[model samples]
Target chain A: MVKLRARCLLLGDAAVGKSALCHMFHSDGTLFQKNYSMTTGVGLLMKCVNVPETNDSVELYIIDSAGKETLVEACEKMWGQPSLLCLVFDLTSEQSFASCSHWMERVHAHCEGLHVPGVLVGNKSDLSARREVQGSVAQEWAESQGLEYHETSAKEMENCDAPLLGLARAFHSLYQERRETIQNLSPG
Target chain B: MIDSSLTSLGAKVVVATSSDENHPPENIIDGNTTTFWMSTGMFPQEFIICFAEPTMISAVTVDSFNVKHLKIEKNTSQNASNFAFVGEKELEHTDGHIQTNAVSLNGSSATHLRFIITSGYDHFVSVHRVSVQN
Candidate 1:
């Protein structure tokens, strides 16, 4: 079995449930904290995902960074060339959805124009009553940014693993593609 | 007395809780903001800077990233122990740029200055430079 490691950066506006999603994914839904202190910098969490129907696994080093504007600069310094991006936003808050563009721009700038595989996650799906961002609108935006879209409720522990699992699979595919390219270069 | 960079006057990082080969503790006093000392994903990380002699420090400026609560301590002893509380500051967050925070030491004389990063906004914090004025 091939084992790969990828740095996955989790970013969003403050109090948008980035930490909750990360914790739920890391602990396999066994743990969830209701009260959370605001993240000041980047919080590192790691989990290994087995790619379905393949003898490969990818260990995702999830960097859950602070989403506060004041801390973005400090958080960016530690981002250190992420292999995947998980741009999270609150489904109930239209402002959080609006900020996704700014977050994308910052990530792209940090990546130095490289194409970093990513997904746009609209969290807090359980709060459908207060939902301000429609799924279709978010999906269209995700398409425009070349990202897959997923909606999850970290509080309800629903579909919390799909986004990260998708990231692992995407990274594994990229690795496979690169390997194929190298093999094609062989003279034999 | 003339204000000078502590690193130019032989200030050395004697103790650090964590170290990285690419971003070493020495980078804190190297007088270069581009090169930095990065912590290895833990809380309450600290480093001690020892001066060649007991010098009166007027103020200190630290250029860092993601640091939250910073505590400063000092000592006049030749050894690297017995520290007295100097000061503390909660760094303000900045976006897209390193935080350049100036801390006043109130003209305290010390042979060793300890910088304890009690907390940070991120899991890992990077201190780019620490300059002292006399």
Candidate 2:
């Protein structure tokens, strides 16, 4: 059994339910705060996910950062190097969806041209009547960016764990691939 | 009348709640914003700095990251204990660069200064440097 650790960065626009989604995932749907003060900096949360039909597990160190433009610089300094990304946006707000591009650019810049495994999360799915970003559009954009797309309603605790679980599996597979390459390098 | 980094004037870190080998407690008074002391994690983390002698301090400049609330205390005694609350500030959050904030100390005299990071924007907080103005 292999135990791995990965730093997962959570980025999104303000009031897009980034914090809500993190809290839901961390608490296993047991806790969800209705009133959230804007996250001033980065909020750190951790959870371990087990890979199905395997003894391996990945511990995700989730760095939930403030989405406010004013605090982005400060948050970036603490981001260090992330192994995975969870780019969230509110389904109800088109502006929030539009800001995903900027967030992606920022993350890419931070990675220094290295590919980081990630997913695009369209949160607040419960507010379907107010939705401004269609699911098909988000899915297409995610595919274009080489990312998987998932819809979640953190308030309703629906599909809150899938994205993170997917991240853990992705990280585990990357680890396995690296191990295989190193093994191949060794002489018999 | 001269402002100086406390470490240059013989300040020593007496105690730190948590420490990391890569980011030690001594980095706080090292006078360099690039080098820093990072908290391992958790709230109400603190550190104590003892000066060579009791000196009058007008203000303190802190270069840090992820710090949300800071509470400062001081003592004139020689030992590490006996602290009196001096001041507190709710730090403003910043992105990318360090949060350089000058907190006025009301010209208080002290031999020891205690900085308690009561809370932070993240689980980990970094103190780049701490300087004092006389």
lDDT of 2 by residue, A33-125 (tens): 899789999999988889777887777889999999999999999887677899999999999999999999999876745567889999999
lDDT of each: 0.83, 0.83
RMSD of each candidate relative to the true structure: 12.5, 12.3
Q: If scored against the real structure, what TM-score would every candidate get?
A: 0.58, 0.58
lDDT of 2 by residue, B20-128 (tens): 5556789888876767776654457899999999989998888887789999999999987889998899999776667888888899999999999987765457787
In candidate 1, the second chain superimposes onto the true chain B with a TM-score of 0.95
Residue A120, model 1: lDDT of: 93
- Candidate 1, residues A1-188: lDDT per residue as tens digits? 56666678999999999999988987898678899889998899989889889877777889999999999998899998667899999999999999999999888886645567888999999999999999999999999998889999988899888898788778777766543332233111
Least well predicted 10-residue stretch by lDDT in candidate 2 chain A: A179-188
Per candidate, the number of residue pairs that clash is 6, 6
Off by over 4 Å in 1: A186-188, B1-134
